[model samples]
Target: MSPQGHPWQKQPDWRILDTQFGSGNTFLATWLTWLEDADHPRLLHYVAVCQQPCSASELIKHFEAHPKLASLALELSHHWFGLLPGFHRFLLEQGQVVLTLCVGEPLPMLRAQQFEADAIELTLPHTCQDELSWFLKAIAHCCRRGTRLVMRHADAAETPGWPRVLTQCGFTLEPMKSDGDDSYRQKPSSFSGYFDPAWTLQRTRPTTKTGPLPVLRCAVIGAGLAGAAVATSLARRGWQVTVLDQAETPAAGASGLPVGLVLPHVSSDDCTLSRLSRAGVRMMLQQVSELLNVNRDWAPSGVFERQIGGTPKLPLTWSSEGTQWSANGHPDGDVALGSGLWHPKGAWIKPAALVKAWLNQPGITFLGNAAVTDVRRQGPTWVLSNNSSEMLCEAECVVFANANGAFELLQKMKHSALDTQAQESHLPSKQGMLGLLSWALHAEPEEARFAPFPVNGAGSIVSCVPTENGLTWFMGSSYQPDAQLERSDQENHLRNLEHLKELLPSLAQKLAPVFEAGTLHAWKGTRCITADRLPVVGPLDATDQPSLWICAGMGSRGLSFSVLCAELLVARMGAEPWPIEAKLARSLEALRA
Candidate 1:
């Protein structure tokens, strides 16, 4: 309550921060409290730092012991296993509740971020006595005037950052009823009054919008996986989304692949791609679990990545189910001569089903066979047109999400006013012919030929797909720049069969009849690839432009990456808290200026 005898209230956009996320008990309590309070904030945001999170199974066990938290804890456990040293966002309660978990040493994590906290829970470790001042200073970086903080320790008087450090950080300590409990409130201070203020003199501050200000409407071009995913995310957020595709059907591009693996990539240096893939695989799994037929269109059969001759050393050791083994040991006691990384969460997914499902969301309209040839920004709305210059639709914001077509559509949108010939002349030209089959061309292969788990080697293979015709294996995706669009060549089948033979010699030999008969299933679709070979997400222009966004360049990982890319794009558009760390978000930025 305020001094004026009125109830003091906090905004529904309440943000709480914890210096330490020991086991997420603070988060669970707060969440339960929110669930019980009808007037609670519409968005409950919690940010916590942890050096090392407990294993997923352990966390799940801890939560399961409590009957109240059993269900939600199980949900959390699904996303709790990422050991990467970065921020991980978990969307709970359908994103109304958000948990941003940063894995890093306390001081470094706090120093790297700039956000205002309405409530702070100081649960710093007692062992870090030498760096007490630094920790307090970093905590102050996120504190604003009027913020309330509570610290818990075994001995209140023996806290590493005593009253002196708290005072130095502009905190007014108050006596608490419990001896081990210390409470404080942010003291009144000028912007520059605090020592080592976070802000620097600037003409304008950066905008970190967390939700739509006034309107939520967009036209997402391309009905492939990326576009459909973007459209679905926006539609889920109450946005009216219109998805346009040049083809008669969705996933008619590279996303048309009948089967693809959602496996994480690992590099010795933990490269950006590997990190992005890990996070991406997690995001896709969430969507897949919620929507899509398990063991039919998709399954968590896990993926084994074999490292053959001259196998490069990975930054992290290979381990599955907590059992670490190297190639030299062949820990599984297999005839295979190389060590492999097992992605238990990674699995095979039929891309087309996902694309169709995503587009089926309420408020999302898919316009197929209505090829979009040009786009232009009017005073406020973005106009779409066909190749005949016929108007298609107009909307406030436009998202380019069609694989390689995104690159071309954006060019048309940027120069829509110019003469058709002039526009073509100004457009970037690429003359290349690329490889093998796209779209599932089926052949009946014996069911036993399928593997117990999906195998990802040079090309890859998926087993046990019950298609309309018969039981078949979808394989042989040639990542070639010289391949024609939507055309399958028998030679590509030979190549795919050869790659399959290399991965599973005995199985390929058993399926030799199908290979020799040129009856192996295949698909032909052009995959969009950035120079970096990573998905391009976020705004096309970084200057906070009003009407342009992009989610393309998915390449071969379309199934694995489309959901996250779409998630980020929609989050940015609707002003929602991003689902991934800022560093990673920046890396996936549209691959443009």
Candidate 2:
């Protein structure tokens, strides 16, 4: 496909869907071509489907013939893991190139996509020809007018009625354009066509009719992890993001935690939360690797989980990939005294560092001390005002990432400038406060007997976290539903020591004296949580089009879920390929209650 002269090439973004992906040569070629073109689309999204994906080594070998492309393939191989059954997103070439690899039956996978493709490529196996009509119909759902389609077959005689089937579908056949490699005409057969249906095609999923936004401007109402992540994602997509925070500095809310654990949740049936956590952990780790300093701001030292009463129960169909993420473990006395589960990819991250990094991205503007109290839709744009009714700013859209503050803002909208339909809409939680208490103690270099990595079960203990004073060990995070309720620091410290005693008895014994002496420091924060415990992301109301959105309810997993939820929100707004499956994406929707 030529990057120039095509109508889509002039657009801001171009999407391609491939029915059959064998060895991933086509994707590599397309990515290389996009790199070579100076006037290429701002974003290139390539979606490919395959039943069995090749290993990283196999990919490297496949590109050996093309030496120039081999280096790019090697770079792609770094993120070539965890190809399970559903969608996997890889942000390549500094986030300009997005690859969504769907591992399943091609036809069913095509049906799952939400956006219309600008181009389509087919190289179906012989077995799929029997269901060719159904496959073509599925392809039609993701096609728009003038969408280019190229089909490669073994020979013209092998598929005699293919031209008739193309007409029956929405495509109009055209002569194949020959490049300098004319030798291909003597061997295999290829047909080129464009989607020019005589009748209108009914699409089940919502498609973007207005294309990219004329003005990519957004205002995020929190400067914590969630709001910072939303700002960063939109900024990377060329949006002018203005991040406003109530505090004097970013991450002065729940995201101000010293350190937090990032691990996948496990369940017997692999519930929705479990799957979503896995997706979140993957995205979080990738971001931490890219933006933060390893070992200082974050560490991939893995987590040792103590399965209090019993062993961890994973899904019965757990694959090797699942084991790689989490598996049964029998550790020596140093890590944990008893048997439990081990997460090789689990990490401990300082949330504030990540938030600061996201807010410092190129296209983002951070404005602190701008606590928005009133939000009203004015014409096509949304306006924000402070508690004193002083105007903060106006934008094409507004996202409430201010945890429990979102509920109050939405409540204000119900009686303010919101439309009649929006006024009657249900607002987010009013009881959004969840208090968490954790304590830390300074440790001398010689006296640090804590575990090498983090240990979690009833609670978590992270040791050797670098602080300005020296090395510190953090432990015990007691949960309370009401943030306003009175609770003493000593009481929370004692509660944390109780969990430390269960998680690491020897270490707990070594540090008990500090707790008794009242030398341990207490850190308390209030997290916003929904009743179901999943994050709320997407539109704020059920109108035909929504201008106000919310990304909150991150709870304790903000370090893990913030980036994933942010990307999911931007994906829905731009109609780009989703970061997770549509079902999982919907589970975190803003107004899903």
Candidate 3:
């Protein structure tokens, strides 16, 4: 849908929305037309809404009749099953074309989604318009100033004043060729300008620049899930990312664990973390399947979580059937959920492997044993250095993902930096004093050192984590707030054993032999947390951070939230549509809390 008398030409990052995606005909036609046009948008976000979408086979079978749409429909069929009941995102043409299919009533779907559409297409009957009101309301929510609306009325003559109604919805109708002839004023006339080139700028897409995103270099501290995910995301966007960590290799921190569970947090109110977790998990499922070995490095088969002290009444969305567990089912390993819900999409993952995979991406490089002590803004670049005053590296963009170390560094940078012109005045953390300042400031990290906001009160448990020995279960990552990496592994393992005893006594008893034999394995790693458990995913200012950003404080949900947080960070940096909503993005803003 062009703006002026221009024939539609290539316009990168154009959005085409179909209010009623019936039988997939409109989507197919638009896709084919886009393919035919040499000047089509570089990225086409085709959002389709269907109230009761047919099954993939049903839709495919119907398309078989149309030779023109067969091939495209077949390719679409592969990802068709992903369309469950709500929103399903499918990437095609290597992400050039993205299809966000909403399987629900049009009104709710449109209301839930936030996007600025360049073109809106709707087909209505010529007779009485039954669902016209709600449709217009939903359309208005997503339309921008220059958005063009295309309406096809079967009986334009019978539907008297349809164009007039459109005007009330803020849509100016261009003149149309009467029932037989042509040429009028403003109305939803023939599809003349619908495909014509009227668009000049790719305004909706995320890229603040006038042209393509420039080849940029960035340095990400920490090789754990958070840092690796951020590095991977930026690299995917053509940014040269160097992932530096003090550890010898990636995922050597909490992300180094052999197995981590990926599941959604459910709550009656569906708290922010719950919502963020679900979205994060949904996105992670795709990334893991694409990047790591399924069932080996990753598994989406499902998970069973046994609640203790009574399952915190889950939201209606998490209600599952068929699989019921009881904390007493297995007397030997007796941890029957008594009636725990099953997470069909919940899976176990090797966080270490995933981190390495991300680090291997085209533009990503991992620097091991490279500990970055502090960062200082020097004009346009940030200078990173080791404790010995040795320059580690410098880049225009610097992201802090080294967990609480980031918090410590920030505190050092703030309290120590003076208003002097000399380099020594810029920052002290780069020197040995940074560490001394941090230790002196909080020698006994108060109980409030780094804690969850509102405190989840919800403890964590890991089960069925694959390790060097065999399939092992890990539980109870005791939130030893401010407890750095000094805790003994044996002590934490024993602590975890106690957690099992409290969570599921019977199972604890069944596994008593391991404790008796001292064979119970455990690991200790610090989890970066904030006032809220959600990761600080955006700029430090909640808005602008030309070169500085943070993707930390994931707590223990690092595995579940890494990919989503990474993508959100990238979208923010590149100015693209976020994988989640705007409000949710705000909730995860690093500086918001």
Best by TM-score: 2
Kindly give the stretch of ten consecutive residues in candidate 3 with the minimal lDDT sum: 431-440
Error of 1 at 379 (Å): 3.1
Instruction: Using lDDT, give the best candidate's number.
Output: 2
Indicate the worst ten consecutive residues by lDDT in candidate 2: 180-189
Candidate no. 2 TM-score: 0.92
Against the reference, the lDDT scores of all candidates come to 0.66, 0.78, 0.62
Clash totals, every prediction: 17, 1, 27
The residue-by-residue lDDT of candidate 1 on 377-434, one tens digit each, is 6766778999898888888888888777777765555554333333234223332224
